[model samples]
Target: MTFLRDLLGIPGASSDPAALAAAARDRSGADPDGLPLAVVRAEDIDGVRETLRLAHAHHVPVVPRGAGTGLAGGALAGTGAVVLDVSAMDRIVEIDPVDELAVVEPGVLTATLDAAAAEHGLRYAPDPASAAISTIGGNIATNAGGMRCVKYGVTREAVLGLDVVLADGTLVSTGRRTVKGVSGLDLTALFVGSEGTLGVIVGASLRLRALPERTLTAAAGYDDVASAARACGDLARARRDPAMLELLDGLTLDVIDRAQGTDHGRRSRALVIAQADGPAADAEIAAIAEVLGKEASWVEQGVDAASSDALLAARRLALPSIERFGKALIEDICVPRSRLADAFAAVEEIAAEHRVAIYSFAHAGDGNLHPIIGYSGEARPAGVQRAADAIFRLALDLGGTVTGEHGVGLLKRDWLAREVGPDVLGLHASVKAALDPRGILNPGKAL
Candidate 1:
């Protein structure tokens, strides 16, 4: 504690009990292993470097945190660790419309950057549901994906370069501002999704896109989630590339209806919401509606902007709506688009077999599903653990991943080996060893 205070002499340093307790945990709902030694609210790159230097010399573990909105416990601090809170370093350095790029500090909010880009007739493309609150550093750390991922890809795609502070407090810059660069081993991509294990992210150069000329939204009602998933597959088969596509299951719809006082469940057992942007948005949405109409019980297309936002709000409310029931164990699994219906069927089967209620929603265009299991207890039930394991195995069986965008934090660490095999797992350890030989950076998380 004394060491941390001395290292960061800035006013941002704190050892308050309340602040330490709050800094120890993230949104994952998992209890921290123990309280952190201290919380250092870094306001600039020098503060981060100094903190890391002290921690490295003392062999104290350091946890790099952004907005603390991670769902995978990646930011949770453990015993004897130093929590380096970087959210105070929020600054947008530059926005170059001509080059379609933006240079920003890691602590800048995702939505704030997009809003700034919009001022220049451009926009940042990667938008997670928590874009309004989550920091860019956190998104880049997890390589986050959202509904727009179906078209624009994930955070890794938008990042052009990074300024990282290694475990030994060495500052190194990777990548270039130009669109094309193969100057080296693409270390920027490696650090983007490293979950703060290899190094601490201080700054980033991000790619931006021009705002769409036109946009359209469409919604379809189906008798079941399987039907809606099949419709998504049909859209893919027909080569209809929507900017955003989301799906909600019957149980999820019921929860949302109860919370929002809407009759979505009464209207249909499942719902599919989609959006198309750019010059061909109208034609793309028309084709999407035609394909979904084939199996949908009802179809609504070309909705007004306000109505479209209202419809999209339902999808965003899925997680919080279910959380009201109890402690929700949110699971992120993705399968091949062709096997989406099969995956949903397997989820239903698992829920029934385990005698647990599982509400699900999805980024259907990309085949990433969120299966939420709720429980009312101080500790997670054994059945819930079994059900989660079954879901991960099911994803592997269908040629998918245990996690699509959420990185493997403590919750998914054990299953990572099952997904990547022994050889690749060894390679991951080697990389971690090379980057952080002392193993003091965010230990016991990610790999």
Candidate 2:
């Protein structure tokens, strides 16, 4: 403890019970094996390097953390480990409209970056629901995707370069500021979704987009979730490139209705929300509404900005609204666009078979579903685990990954091998070993 304080300065390190308890868990609902020894709040890149240097020398495990809004248990710290907190490093170093990039610290809030970009007539396209609170470092660690991902892609797509601290506390810069570069091994892409196992991200240069000239939103309601999912596929097949496309199941709509005092569920069992931006925004949404109307019970097109926000609220409020029912174990599974309907059907069957309450929503255009399993009590119900397992298996069966946006933290570690096969899994092990021979950086998580 004294050594850590000396390395990071007194204000940067703490062994306080409250700090340890807060750092011990994330929003994943998985309890930490035990509390961390201490929480070191690193305010700068030098502080991060110093803490890692000490941890490497002492052979102590370190868990690099951002805002703690991660859906997977990637940031959870356990006994004998040090929680390296970087949320205090929030700073937007520069926003270059000429180069269409933003240089930022790892701790900068996702929304803050977008807002700053907006001031320069640009926008940050990745918008995970947690963007309002989630940090860029955490997004990069998990390679998070949001509603806008259907068009702009995920965090990896926005990142132009990174300043990473390796396992041995060696600071290395990978990637470039230009739009395209393939100089070497492409280590930047490798570390983007590594879940902090190989290294800790300290700073990033992010790509930005010009603000759209116009924007429009449209929504449709269906009698069943499968129909709504199919509508998403239909829009994709028709080559309608929407900036955002979201789907909410009946149970999810009900929960949101109760929480927000809206009547979305009463109107239909399912809802599909779509947003189009740029020069042809109006024409694109009209086409989207027409395609949705083929299978939809009701369709609302060209909605006013306020009404569009009201419609989009269902997706933004999904996880929190479901949590109101009870503790929610949110599961992320993505399937091929052609099989989204089949995947949703399997989720319904799994929920019924296990007798658990599962409310699902999706970034439908991308086939990423978030099926939240709600339960009561201090201990997670066995049926909840069963239902979640069944969901993961079905996703694999449908040729989809177990996780779409969220990284395979402690919760999804067991199913990773089954999805990637032994050969690829061995490759993962090889990579981990080469990068972190001592295995002190975020051990026993992503791999």
**Residue-wise lDDT of candidate 1 within 204-297, one digit each (tens)?**
9999999998878899999998899999999999989999999999999999988888888999999999999998888888988999899999
Please write out the lDDT profile of model 2 over residues 1-447, one tens digit for every residue.
Answer: 656566446358888889999999998888898889888999788888888888888888999999998888999999989999999999999999999999999999999999999999999999988899999999999999999999999999999999999988899999999999989988999999999999999999999999998778889999999899989999988998898989999999899999889899999999999999898888888998999899999998655678778667778888878777678787899999889889888899999999999898888988898888999887999999999999999999999999999999888888998999899999999999998888988888989
lDDT of each: 0.91, 0.90
Clashing pairs in 1: none
Q: Clash number for model 2?
A: 0
TM-score of predicted model 2? 0.97
Provide the lDDT at 55 for model 1. Answer: 87
TM-score of 1: 0.97
Each candidate's number of clashing pairs is 0, 0
lDDT score of model 2?
Answer: 0.90
Given candidate 2, what's the lDDT at residue 242?
90
- Quick one: best lDDT, which candidate? 1
Clashing pairs in 2: none
